[model samples]
Target chain A: MLEAISDWLQSTWLSHAFISQGLWAWPMSESLHFMGLCLLVGSVGLIDLRMLGMARGISVAALHKLVPFGVGGYLVNVLTGSLFVIGDADQYIFNDAFRVKMLFMLIAGLNVLFFYSSAFQKTKLLGPDDSMPLNVKIMAGVSLTCWIVIISAGRLITFYRP
Target chain B: MEALFIWIETSPLSLWVRGESGWHMAFPIIIVFHALGMGFLVGVALAINGRVLGLAPQVPLGKLRQFLPVAMLALVVNVISGILLLIGYPTKALTNPVFYIKLLCIALALWNLRWFSYSVLTNPIYDHGVLPQKTRQLATASIVLWASAIIAGRLLAYTYNNMMSI
Candidate 1:
């Protein structure tokens, strides 16, 4: 079933565009991906450090504003990442490293959902003197680990290609 | 320089890194670590620069300094990994002008970090207030420098003319 989907996707026009563009497309996408990685990790990682009680002098609300840049970075990655997958579906769909990356991304997504639903309100109420709860700290730790692993695994994809 | 490149290329460590047998994984793993280090270093710099630019005015500049240690740690990782990479393929990088450009950008960015720390982060007014024009200008320059550094580093792969000893 996965192979079928991959085959169909590779046959699509998006894939043709990516292939036809040839040399420039891959490099451009890779460059953008790297930029997005920096932006996402920088902003979101700062927020994570704050939640983990590293920079308690900063108000949580103010640090929260940086999350939008992280989100913007994520969007850029998703768009470029999709183009990559569309361009060469077989390279990703059947690859173990890509599968692991997807798993990590899914877990990271769930962690975000949990953060907003359960912890964001409490975080918003926090003043400079207040410390984040243990649960929030755990979530922040998980987020940092996941992102680091995701990046590592993403790089490993080339090595682990089938 | 050619002799040095040849000597380094034939060294045991470099040979191991370039070897196509059991040690093949070493080079790619080093590259992966390089990317990870770049993410942390550049990312933290961006956050600090953003804060300096008043993106999060409520966060004290001094408090943001806490992230500096982590960024420094990442820089250390990058330096070590980068050296190993250069050892593995000295000719590829040393022969390329882009690599030196990357180094220059990194040096300037680090200098900008120190300058910001001394001039703006330590200032009490920037604790919970807007940064002065001069500090803001430094912050902007820091961002541009780091961005350029990343680009130059990425372009190294494409720009190199020699893959082994010159």
Candidate 2:
């Protein structure tokens, strides 16, 4: 089933462009991917650290404003990530490291949903020095760990490629 | 130069780093750390850069100082890992012009951060409003340099003339 999906995705125009766009495409997208990684990690880390009780002088609500940039980074990475998987699906779908990366990303995604559904309002009301609720701290901790694992696994993809 | 590159590449530590000897996981581990270090180092700097550009107007500029320690520690990680990587492939990085550009951009970006540190961050009176023109310029320049540095670093893999001397 996975192989079939990979084949179908590879037949798409997106994969065609990614495969034939000359030498510049891969490096260019990789650069943008790295840039997006930095932007997303930085903004999200700032908020996470703050929620977990570091950077106690910055208000949660104020820092939340930076989420837009993180969202932008997420969009850039999704686009670039799609290009990679679409162009060379077997390289990712059959790679354990890539699978782990996707798993970690899924965990991170679920954490995002949990935050908005359960903690967003209370988080917004948090003052700079207020003690974070245990669950919120858990969310932040999970997020930080997931991102670290996701990045590590993503880097290992090349080494583990099929 | 050739002799120097060969010397470093054949060193025991480099061999270990390159997975030619010792535990084979070292190279991947080093690069993994490098990426994590980048996430913290560049990430925090970009956050600070965003702050300076008035993205989070209510946050005290000095408050951002709380995050610098993590970035500093990450910088240390990158330096150590970067040196190890360079040792493992001196010819690859040294022969590539993009590598030098990346280094220069990083140096200037750090210099830009220092300028922001002393001028804007330390000023207790200026946390919330429009900062001085020069201060904004520093952040803008830091942002540009950081983006360029990352792009150049990525390009090094594609542009290198030699993988190693030996």
Candidate 3:
């Protein structure tokens, strides 16, 4: 069951060390989390906006160069987020907000997948100022909405604690 | 100042912000706004700083200016939501030294944003991504100041001496 996994995660050395780091640990991780969020949003959101036809005269190929930063940010969040759950598994596993947040993250991930697989070829070929096709724009919208919901759900986690 | 804190803390709107009739919606929603705004504002700033430091050179620096408006919009949203949250717990925030540090960092960060806007973003000279030395330095400072602001803001919850009219 989920409880067993939570127990096992908490028993791990990483979680033990994380929790033992005293009061500042949580805030420090949170600060890092916020920074990582900036990186992800800044890079990924830029691409989305470009695909949505907001920042014209910028080629998708050029803006896509920032993908590494977004990936880096995503990794940072995953690691820090794991620490949160590992350090206090019960805080997240049974939490509806956390569940919702995870769902949003999954959707965002899938949205990106679908884009690169289907839309990226056509969109990337478009000129600097050319508008994206309607389908591509829909994906861009979905990406933005998913991220917004993910953020809101994250904020709601503490409040929605069960 | 103490009286002002007390008054702000007791206002009907402030009470609602803290939460009302078990709604508990206002505070968390405001915080979400704060988070979303921070993501865009700080995130876009980071991207710009990266470009100045030679991260993404193909994108014309001037073309990047279009994104600044979104960051500005984020700033506006945060300012409004931040005020709402402050009104909710004036004593908790105002009485804290870290709060002032956060404010200072934000002010300086905004100053850096303005400098970057005029000096680098608006200047067609750097359009090809070849930034001046000073512009690069300012971009570095922007990153540091923003990180400091976020750190100071995060630390506020732990560093505050008084939660309310103690």
Candidate 4:
């Protein structure tokens, strides 16, 4: 069944059209994807740093406003990234580097959900001039590490052309 | 102009970077780290800068400092990883004007970031210290700089004259 799925994807018109068109389309999507990446990194970096005590003057809730922009970045990347898959679904689906990248992305996505569900709810301590709880700190640390790994994996995908 | 390009491309390191060897493996790994480093570094910077400029006022300023180490550490990683990537493809980046633009944007953004971090954003006077009106300008610039840098970096792949041209 899985082999059939791969064969179908390789033989599909969508893949041929996209790949042919992607000479230009690929670069454009890549550009937008990078832009989105910057947004996610920028917003997440600020909040995570704030949580860690680097910028002692910014409020936690205030920093949280940047999350929407981060989400916006993520959305842009997903939309543009799909183009690549549609263009060559089999190439990426079977690629080990691609698989690793997807794994990191999934982990990062889950980490964000975990953050909102648990850390976002602990708002009492998010007050002005209060110390962050250890759990929140841990979350921040994990989020930062996970994001780094995800980006690394994404770049690796290009090199690992299986 | 062709001679200069050739000179760069012929450099021992440049030849090694593109040559099919360990770089085949190293290139992708380093690129991944570079991307991640950018995300962490910029992500932290944007979030902190956004709040400092008063985008989100509910969270306290002091409490947000917990994430700085991550950004700083990521920056360090990028610096190391970026250098490796650069060494891997010295001519590809050196010959490209867009690459220089990306680097310049990053430098200015980081410069502006340093100024904002030390001055208006961290002033101890406001409640958890509200950011000064002036700092917002820096934050805006930071956003622009990073956005441009990322775009320019991506263009490097498309814009550069590849081995076929050489």
TM-score for chain B considered on its own, for each of the candidates: 0.94, 0.97, 0.95, 0.81
| Residue B96 displacement (Å), model 3 | 1.1
- Over the stretch B103-165, how does candidate 2's per-residue lDDT look in tens digits? 999999998877777777888887788877777787889989989998998898889999989
lDDT per residue as tens, model 3, B1-166:
8888888878888888889635678888889999999999998899888888888788888888899989999999999999999988899898888999999999999998888888778888787846778888888998999999999988987898888872
Candidate 1 per-residue lDDT, tens place, B66-139, comes to 78888889999999999999898999998899999999999999999887767767777777777678878888
Question: For every candidate, what is the interface RMSD in angstroms?
Answer: 1.2, 0.8, 0.7, 3.2
Which CAPRI level is candidate 1? medium
lDDT of 3: 0.89
lDDT of 2 by residue, A8-122 (tens): 9999998998989979999999989988999988888789989899988788998888889999998999999999999999899999999999999999999999999999998
List-wise, what DockQ does each model earn?
A: 0.76, 0.90, 0.87, 0.57
For candidate 3, list the clashing residue pairs, or say none: none
Please report the TM-score between candidate 2 and the true structure: 0.98
Off by over 4 Å in 1: B19-22
Q: What's the TM for model 1?
A: 0.94
lDDT of 4: 0.72
lDDT of 2 at B47: 87
Predicted candidate 3 versus true structure: per-residue lDDT over A37-65, tens digit per residue: 89989999889888888989899888888
Return whichever of 2 and 3 wins on TM-score: 2
* Per-residue lDDT of model 4, residues B62-141, tens digit only: 44455667777878998898776676666677778888998999899888767756664465554354665666677788
